[model samples]
Target chain A: MVVVSLNNVTKKIGSKTIIDNLSFDVHAGEVFGFLGPNGAGKTTTIRMLVGLMKITSGDIFIDGHSVKANFEEAISKVGAIVENPEMYKFMSGYDNLKHYARMVKGVTLERIDEVAELVGLQNRMKEKVKTYSLGMRQRLGIAQALLHRPKVLILDEPTNGLDPAGIREIRDYLKRLAREEDMAVIVSSHLLSEMEMMCDRIGIIQNGRMIDVQLVNDMVNGGNVSYVISAKPIDQAFNVLQHAFEGINVKMTKQHLHVEGESVDVPKLVKRLVENQCDIYEVKQVNQSLEEKFLEITSEKGGIA
Target chain B: MGLLANEWIKIFKRKSSYIMIGILAIIVLVAAIGMTFINNQGTETGDNGNWKTALEAENKDLKEELKSTPGPYKKEVERVIAENEYRITHEMPRVTSYNVWTFMNGMMGLVDIVALFTIIIAAGIVASEFSWGTIKLLLIRPINRAKILLSKYITVLLYALFMLAILFVLSFILGAAFFGFEQNQPHLAYLDGQIVERAQIPFLLSQYALSSVGLLIFTTMAFMISAAFRNSSLAIGLSIFLLLVGSIVTSIIAGFFDWAKYLLFANTNLLPYFGTGTPMVEGMTLAFSLIVLLVYFIIFLVVAFWAFVKRDVAA
Candidate 1:
């Protein structure tokens, strides 16, 4: 089900367009990643989605309510953290959650405690947010956004300032929330690898316009899968694979042979290398990362990469 | 209501608010202690025992001066003569010792301190959110912009009232503790050739309310500046600067321009109209001042709500 939909939403600041005719839908039980480089209007789009900024033209709907006409109803179904989780440093972590919970109805103290545990901050909830590290702050922010049990959770640059472990923790936590709560999560990030592990589907935006939207699976291994073979005498292995698998795209890199083919053909190429008396030291399947896919998509559109 | 509680809690969580209240309380205690020490020096007037005869002689001399000089100071002299005659007839002593009522009256000036603290809160209540980058999360709540802004504005006014209560109640308690309620007389006023007598506590309370009219206006101005600009320093500085000098500037302008009657400070002190005193400008009536104040109050609120509701949360 489409939990949130942006129908041709446009945002213009003065004469310059910040987000132009952006359109997409986020479904429940799925993590949708908004990917783009810096200054690609990713943050602006998130701002409009949560009603922080106005849409110059077009409309956005959240849970069947129009965001422009019925803002309170639409936004009530969403919990978002735009930019950094800049909370009141003087207030304790629990107090910050309570503060946000007070803004919405039906949030009891138990719910506040439950969310604190969900974010793994229950032990430190009474401590001031100033004492929290960036990771703890991010978790507290997520905990705040979840207090109201919103149907949609939108986080812009959720991993902007976290170490690898913290980033992984957030990624796994978000994925679990999306699956267990059946909530639609929208995460925007410039890091391709993070999105690959976190998002189920992604929409790539560039220069205030969406360039591509696809399932993460199709985006990574939709067309061709590459295999990297590091063997003795790389040129011999390269020629053996090129001759055995006719019309296959094979390249001879330094000390390795890169072969582009299906998984079924990778083993066949490896068998032929051994039959031709070439040493098969190692053979590994290489999945094209979302970063390369992004470059490929941009280059296909003949735009600036 | 929830929003208001949230804002109220947010304010008290900071140390600055406690500091403000502490400073105000200390000022009152120090001022009272200073007065107590000065009065302990036994600076009693020699004429206190025969003040009726002294006032009678002063009235005779004032009547003589009234016959000789006729100028702008004439009305002041006439007012003094009328008050002296009324005092002598009523047997009210001019040189009374310090009492609880007098202490309460003296503490009325401390309403300005309450105003300063209130303005500090008003200035930061809205602007600090933006500066901290918390406005992004704040604006994303289920509440609409108008409701949120209204809650914040109401919180500021409530804070002003709370500070005023602290000042009044604390001063009253302190005054009663140090200076007993001995020989407290009714407040006397010379109004239109008549001596009006008012009970002391009611008179003091009304004086406090009248003084706080200026506080309320200055706090609202600070709030408006805070919402329009995301800089608490600018709001606090500008509002405080105006609060200190607004009336003085209005008086300077009133000397040449009659339209100065419409200035906010000219109308803030409603005590003149309530009690027996001349208006800041000659032609300003009670109704006229109230209307001017109402207009400025509305203008400040309208600008505040407009800026808060209409502007994009870019910061």
Candidate 2:
């Protein structure tokens, strides 16, 4: 089910368009990653979805309620952590959760405890937030956001300032929340590798515009992939493959000769190399990582992604 | 209502809130001690025996001294003689009398301290949420932005009322301890060119309540600044500076221009209309001052709520 939808949402501060006409949807039981460079309007879009900002034109609907008109009804379905997960420093972690729980109905003590244990903050729930580490504060923030059993959860830069283990812990927890609780999760970050491993689908945004949105697997493995060809008489093999695969890009690296084509072309290239008196030892298919794909797509626009 | 409770819990959890109450307690205690010491010194000097005879003697001495006093000092001396004669004729109690009403009256000056502390909290409540970045967490909830702002404002008013109650109850306790609970004392007021007497308890309570007008106005000013600017230090600094210097500046302006009566500070001190002092301007009546204060009060609240509701939590 589509849990969150943005339809032609645009935000303009004065004359400068902060977020151009953007549109996307997040479905249930999946992790949607919003990937963007700095100043790419990722936070701006998230803010509009959560009602922290006004949408200049268009609509955002959470759980089928329009955020612009039915803000209370729409926002009740969303739980978000924008930018840093800043909490009341003087309040204990438990008190902070309790404070927020009061605003939403049916948030009982058991629910609070359940979320605390889910976020792995059960032991330190009594400590003041000012005494908590950045990772601990992030966990507490997630705990508070989950108290209401929101249909959609949004977190901006959830892994920022977290250690490696902390990052892994949050990533693992978010995945569990989506699968086990059947909740749609939207996270925005600039960290590519984390998104590559954690997200099922990603929307890449640049300059207030969404450049592309695709499944993680489709993005990395669905294009004209390159194959690494290894053999003896490396210079001759490279020349034969270059001549055999006409109009296809082929290059020889330090360790192997690289040939770029669809997966089906691999066998034909190998047979041709064999027929050309070239010794072919190995033919390995190389899949591009999301980082490489991201660079390629963003570089096509002539700026940093 | 839940939002208000949330804000209440947040404010009470801070250490500064307790410190504000602590400071008020200490100030009241010190004032109590000082009043006791002065009363003891008056008793030791044998001036506490008969206030009527002492006033008559002082009146005669002041009149004799007025003959040789310069023109500049004559007015002050004559005012003193008039006050002493009025006290003697009206049978008003002596200042050295150990009574609860007198102590409660003395504690009225501490309302300024209450206003100062209340303004500090009021100024920081909204602005600090933005500065600390907690506003993002707050506004993402199910509540409306106006309700959130209203809750904070209500929390501030509740804190102010709490401090005022503490001051009143603590002063009552301290006063009853230092001086006997002497009821039925008439409060003397020099008004309309004569001395008039009214019931003490009601008069003192009204004075305390009336004195809070200044407190509420300054607090609203601080709150408006907090919402409009979202900078805690600037709000606290400017409101406090105005609170401290506003009266002096108003008087300076009032000395030169009759239009100064329309300014905020000119009308804050409602006690003057109750015969605590004369009006700053000649024709400024209690009704006029009350209207002026009400107008300013509405403006402050309108500005505060409007700014708070319209502001976008971009940061």
Candidate 3:
């Protein structure tokens, strides 16, 4: 089932289109990463989905309930931490949980305890939130969000302030949540590697526009190839091979030829280069990373999103 | 209901709430004790004689004045004499716990100061959420914005009630401890150039409690200001400034302009039970002040509710 859906959702702040014609679906049991750079409207989109903001001209539905028309019911199914999670600094973590739990129906004390344990905050739940480290506070935030067993968890930069271990913990917890709880999790971040490991699929956004949405594997799969071919009489061989494959772009660095093209013509091109008195020594396809794909897509639009 | 409770817990968690109540209680306690001291000092004539002699001197002056005045004022003079005679015969002029109660009752017009604090406290309750970057966690709680705002208002009102109740209890307890608990002595008041006294002290004190309802309404106005401004300093400063300016301007107009009484603050003091003091203007009445205040109160409430529920939290 689709847990949350936005159709043609547009948000404008004065004349600036913050989220223009933005549409996406969060299906049940998937860790959907919302990847974008700063000022890319990632937070704005998440805010709209959580009902903290209104869409300029479109429908946002949570479990089939319209966010605009039935905000209370629609929001009840969504657990989100927008921008940052804030708790009363003076109150203990347990008290904060108790206080937030009241807003969510049927959230028993046992459920609060369970969530605290889930977030690994069982030992420090009695301590004031002001004393908590950023990472601990983040875990507590996640715990608070899950107190009501919400079907959809929308987190914007949930690991923004966490240390490496904290990020790993949150990433692992989110993965477990999607798998064990069957929840649809939408996490936004600027970190590509983190998203690559945590998200099953990613939607790349830039300049308040979603440039592309693709599976992590599909995005990084075979998009780049680095080849090291040795050709003797280097200067003359480079000229001959360059003229034979007019469409192919080659870069000669040190002792290697890095050729990036369709794999289908690579063998033929290798034969052509050899016929031109080019003695090719070594050739290999370099693995492309999600970071490279993210950079390529985001840089095309100057990283506005 | 759950939201309201949560809001209440939030309000109580703040240090300002306790500090406000503590200050109010101290003020009420000091005022009660001060009145008792004044009452005691006035009566302990010692070698110069006692309270009875002072009362006799006052009575003598009134008698002398009555005798000197001519026929046209005779009826008024006779009425004053009758009331004075009753007070003297019944020992109603003596100060006791009733006197402190009566004194506080007379000063009830100043209770609007609570409204100023109410605004200051209530404004920060929600505004601090944004200012301190806590609103993000609050908004993600799967609750409607309207409910959140409503809960805030409820929390503010509870704070106001707690402050008032603290004041009330402190005044009564301190008054009784310092001033002997004498119920037979009448509640003393200087009205219409005569000392009018009530038969029941507790009943008069209870009647004075009605003024607090007006105070509650004023505090509600403060809450609205706080909600609209969303900054504690701005809300508190502007509300207090406006309130002080409102009173000063009303007084100035009443003295110079006939329409001054029409200003809501001019006649806010509702202690016209015996109808002694002149209102700021000719037509000014408690009912008229109440109507004008209510209108402004409703407008403030509407704006506060709307802004709190609709405005964005940028922090």
TM-score of chain B of each: 0.93, 0.87, 0.75
In candidate 2, position B51 carries an lDDT of 77
Model 1 achieves a DockQ score of 0.83
Q: Write the per-residue lDDT of candidate 2 for residues A170-197, one digit (tens) a residue.
A: 9999999899989999999987899988
DockQ, 0 to 1 scale, candidate 2: 0.80
Q: Write the per-residue lDDT of candidate 1 for residues A129-149, one digit (tens) a residue.
A: 999999999999999889899
Candidate 3, position B134, lDDT: 72
Across B250-299, the per-residue lDDT of candidate 2 in tens digits comes to 98998889899999999998876666765676688889998999898889
DockQ of 3: 0.56
Each candidate's DockQ: 0.83, 0.80, 0.56
Q: Compared with the true structure, what per-residue lDDT tens digits does model 1 show for residues B1-315? A: 899999999999999989988998998899788878877786666456788888889989998999887453465677778888888888887745777788888898889888898999999999999999999999988888889888988888898888888888888888877877755488876666667888987888888988898888889999999999979999999999998899899989988898999899989988766644557787678899889989999999999999998888887
Candidate 3 per-residue lDDT, tens place, B1-315, comes to: 887787777777878777877767667766766776677767633343354566667778878898787643554555556565666677555443245456555445435656666767766776677676777777766676767877787777777666656555565566667664555555445455566665654555455455565556566666776667667677667667766787778777777777776666765656553433445565555678778767867787788888877866554
Best by TM-score: 1
The clash tally of candidate 1 reads 0
What ranking emerges by TM-score with the best candidate at the front?
Answer: 1, 2, 3
TM-score each candidate. Answer: 0.94, 0.93, 0.86
Ranking of candidates on DockQ, top first:
1, 2, 3
Model 3 stretches astray by more than 4 angstroms? A222-224, A229-248, A264-284, A299-305, B28-42, B46-116, B188-210, B273-276
Interface RMSD of 3: 1.9
Candidate 1: segments with Cα more than 4 A from true spot: A229-246, A261-264, A267-284, B60-75
**Model 3: per-residue Cα lDDT over A1-305, one tens digit each:** 89889899998889988888988898999999999888888988887887667778998999999998988788888887877677788899999999888877798999999999988889998999999999988888888888888899988898897888888988999999999999999999998999998999899888778888998878767465555566666665667667766556777766666665545266776787777767776667676778877888888766533
